[model samples]
Target chain A: MNRQVLLFYPLLGMILLGLFIGGLAYGAVPIPLDHVVDILLGKGSDKIAWQNIVLQSRLPQAITALLAGASLATSGLLLQTLFRNPLAGPSILGISDGANLGVAAIMLYFGGTLGQFADWPISGYMAVILAAFAGACAILGLIIYFSAKVKNNVMLLIIGIMIGYLASSVISILNYYSSTDRVHAFVMWGLGNFSGVSLEQLPFLGSCTLAGLLLAILLIKPLNALLLGEMYAANLGIHIKRTRILILLCTGILTATTTAFCGPISFIGLAVPHIARLMLGSSNHKMLVPVTVLTGSCIALLCNMLMVVPGSNMILPLNAVTPMLGAPVIIYVIVNRKNIQYFN
Target chain B: MAMKQTSVIKTSDLSIGYTLKGGRKKCVHDALNLSLYPGEVTCLLGLNGAGKSTLLRTLCGFQPPLGGKIELMGKPLSSYSQGSFSRMVGVVLTEKTNAGGITVYELASLGRHPYTGFFGQLRQEDHRIIEESLIAAGIAHKAHNYVSELSDGERQKAMIAKALAQQCPIILLDEPTAFLDVTSRIETMVLLHKLAVEQQKAILLSTHDLDLAIQLGDCLWLQEKGRPMACGTPEDLILGGAFETFFSKEGIVFDPGTGKLHTEAPTVPVGVEGDLTTSYWVGNALIRNGFKPSLVSEEYVSVCCNAPNDLRILFPVGDMRIAESIAEMVSIIVHKS
Candidate 1:
């Protein structure tokens, strides 16, 4: 490992600490930094409301941001490598759109009654997560099937976009026929909120995202080989079919978990890897994967912080904030297209 | 020359083809048997649509043979795992892959994946192999440069180096020199020849440059229409008139004299005499002027010069002027004779 990368660990650590502290102290109820530290250390005032607000509300939201960032970023890196497309991200395969469609179907067609069924013993967060997983997997499965048939990367990308359009169209129809209350609930979910996931649901979200991350790590070797191309990866002894399936699964899980919790936050999975690649100046995957994960976490944390700027009551939607960060990197990559070499 | 060593690749009545699944199914090519020997360079020669690449892919075990069997080092190609198969045969494909922002060193290290542990960490021996392969391919200096920065020739070298680092017994290259310049083509051929001779690896390559193929390869696999014929030395093939049969067409005769195709031309003047050395140049000049040169005695030159001829001029310039044409020589020859 390079000494510079080793040096980055402490800096990233400090930034994470600062972000965590800032996330706890800078919310709507603006607790003092000392009180925030005391609450974290279990030494704050013995007030139920304060404890609930700090532990349940802000901490879960911040952790959600951190995990979502890492998961989306890792998902983006995997997709980019697997597809051999710089612009490829989680949504490129329509996984997020698939998740959106699932949420829309449940909220609109099944009515807002579906979300209120969280109290049902078997169908609470598990139901929503499963729904999101199935939806994302459906799109991922289609993408994988098409990927096997269509050897061209750009053509596969177009197909993925078309799939996204189809899913969006389906969601639009559901929204059109639904009642006003259902539409209101679906629209709010569409706005994208990291704070929507409760503390009780955090464990499930965290475990699923972690599993996706582990799978992504397991794919590092094949991903590195894939950076050459599928044929080259096959030449390097990677089972292309199995590797593609694993990638789709990982992408499905990561995107599904994020969508289930945060409601299909866009651009993080598509942009963070590019940012990491630009920062690292290499695509070895051994380095790029880890850096992208950390950078995703950092970016997500930053965006979460930005969503609730201090002294401002108006909080921006996380989706709106992500595009503000992600779109410029994409446009820069496009505008300076010739300067960037995609394949050797 | 057949060595007594173990064969790295053997095809037994192998009919290689791709099965296209649609409303109705079809196979690309019928079964064919081919064997690749250790420590030899086998050049596959064929026209554009002769299924040469398809054959190579099938032989490398990327695609299963439509019929028959392919054995790698006496084991069925399909029997080995992908990692073991990769370790047995390294392939350099014709298309440039997605190398993008990867350095030459990183790309070369990927060749060692079959040997690495779970995380694909490089051992010291792996590093040594990578360094040696880089030096062998003459791309050591470009180790840190992104593969995207290398020229087509350099990139090809790097790719070959990656295969070398893999240290496979069989190396299959598809049109290795297809996009290279003349110098790069020669260098790549020479490199492959060296690899076969020194590393003792069996190298199978497909190429359109028949001349270089004939010059460098130890054997030739010529695909004509649906049939494939293997030949020994290029000289033997030529002597056997195999090339004539393969490339025969109107206005194109394979010239035995130059070992190349040349158009047949009409004969020129004859019976001109001079010193053998100067006569060579004089003969070339005569041929350019649509005249043929023939050797005769020094006395016959004067007789022929006096006789009527088309058009002839004497050599050795100013002092010596010999006439050999219908106008002046005819009168002189009639009087002298």
Candidate 2:
């Protein structure tokens, strides 16, 4: 690695750390920076409510934002590299849409309850999460099977989008029949919120997200080879079919887990990889992957901080804040793709 | 015309084509016998849709053959695993793969995957080999430049350097010079020829440039739509009357004297005499201007070149014209006749 790339890691790391702290300190309650530091150091604040808000609410939200951001961004980078298309992302293959369809089915069709379908009683958050996982895996299985049958990448992408459209049609029909209260609940979930995961849910969410990230790191060599295209990668002794399947599985898991925990957060998975590539000026995954992970965390935490920056105690949804930061970069990429070095 | 005692790839009665899903076979060329030798450049030349690319892909094991047997290094081509097969052969395809973000060095280093460890970390020896291959391909100066930034010719050299880094005994290229200009096309052909002779590697390539193949190719594989594939030395193919029949068209003929294509235009009889060098050019101008050289007669026109710059045209009507150059002489003859 060059000096510039080496410096990028720590620079992005420090920025992510700063944003994490910012996410914790700046919120609806407007806790002081020193007090936030004191709370993190385990020194109790004089006000019990401020301490609870900082430690229990903001801290977990910040961590969830960081992990989800990294997961979604890495997932985008993998899909982009795998498909050899810059527009590919976690949502492009319809795995995240499949998850959204599952959540819709749960909230709209089953009235947010699983007790009627099975002997074991389940409802609310746990049941919704399970259904999302099942739905994402189901779509992912179809994609994998089609990937084996079709050798063309563009054909597989089209198939994924068609399957997503099918799922969306079903979701729409379910929403049309559901009552107003259930429809309102589903709409809230669709708006997306990073603060949905409580302090208790962080451990399971963190580990699953990290495991997918680890698999992504292990895929660096093959991913770099793939940047040259599948024919060249296969010439270099890499198995194209096996690598394609593994990428689908990794992206599916990351998109499913993050959507299940945080409501299909938009734009991060599609745009953060481009941000990291533009920052690094190189697409060799050895540096791009880790930098993408760090940049994803920083952007997510920054967006999380922006949600309550007005201090009105009426926080904006994560989805609303994400497009403001991400859309401009995507537009810049599209306009200046020739000036930028992307695919040869 | 004599081949080396050892053969790297030998195929017997090989039928090559894509087999459809319903067991329908689309055979391109069948019942073929050919051998590729070390220290030689074998060029595949044919019209479009004649299965040149298919043959190259089959030999590289990218696709399976429809029938018959292919032996690489005296072993069945299918017996070797992908890892072993990659070590045995290196391929440079014509497809424009996007290698924009990777520097030339990193792209070349990927050739060492068969020998590198799991992470593909290059050792000091690997670096030395890569550097040597870059020099061999004449692309060492652009080692740090991104593949996308290089020109078409430079990107081709970079790919060749990558293949050289693989250290495989055989290198197969599908139209490596297809997108190059005249100078770069000749340069790439010369580079491949040099690599074949110096490294003693069996280098096979498919191309549409016949003049280059005629000059530099050690052996040529000629395929047509229905005729059996012909394989021989370039000289033998020309001398044995194979080039005449293979490349014949309605108005186009393959000239054995110049080994070039010529259009069969109508010829007017003319006679040329005088200085040997200028007379040769004057006769050439006659042929180019649809005139055939013959004995001088009262019924036809004749040209005489006494000096390099002076030309005299003698018409049977007894009209005479002197010109300063071949252009003026040919134009006067063309206007009168």
The number of the candidate with the highest DockQ is: 2
Candidate 2 deviant stretches above 4 angstroms: A113-130, A137-163, B1-3, B263-288, B291-323
- Which ten residues in a row are the worst by lDDT in model 2 chain B? B257-266
Clashing pairs in 1: B14-B32, B15-B31, B268-B292, B269-B292
Give the alpha carbon lDDT tens digit for every residue of A69-128 in model 1.
999999888888877777777777788999888777766786654346334343655666
Local accuracy of candidate 2 as per-residue lDDT tens digits, B1-337: 3435688999999999998989999998898798999899999999899899899989988789999999999999989988888889998988656578778998888888778887778899999999999999999999988777888888889999989999999999999999899999999999999999999989999999999999999999999877898999999999998988888868877767557666874457898889988988887777788887666677898888898688888888898889899999988988886
Q: Where does model 1 exceed 4 Å of error?
A: A45-52, A113-122, A341-344, B2-6, B22-31, B249-256, B259-337
Q: Which ten residues in a row have the lowest lDDT in candidate 1 chain B?
A: B299-308
Interface RMSD of 2: 1.4
List model 2 lDDT by residue over A80-118, tens digit each.
887676776767678788888877887798775222222
Best by TM-score: 2
Q: lDDT (0-100) at residue B194 of candidate 1?
A: 93
Q: How does each model score on lDDT? A: 0.79, 0.84
Question: Second chain only: TM-score per model?
Answer: 0.77, 0.89
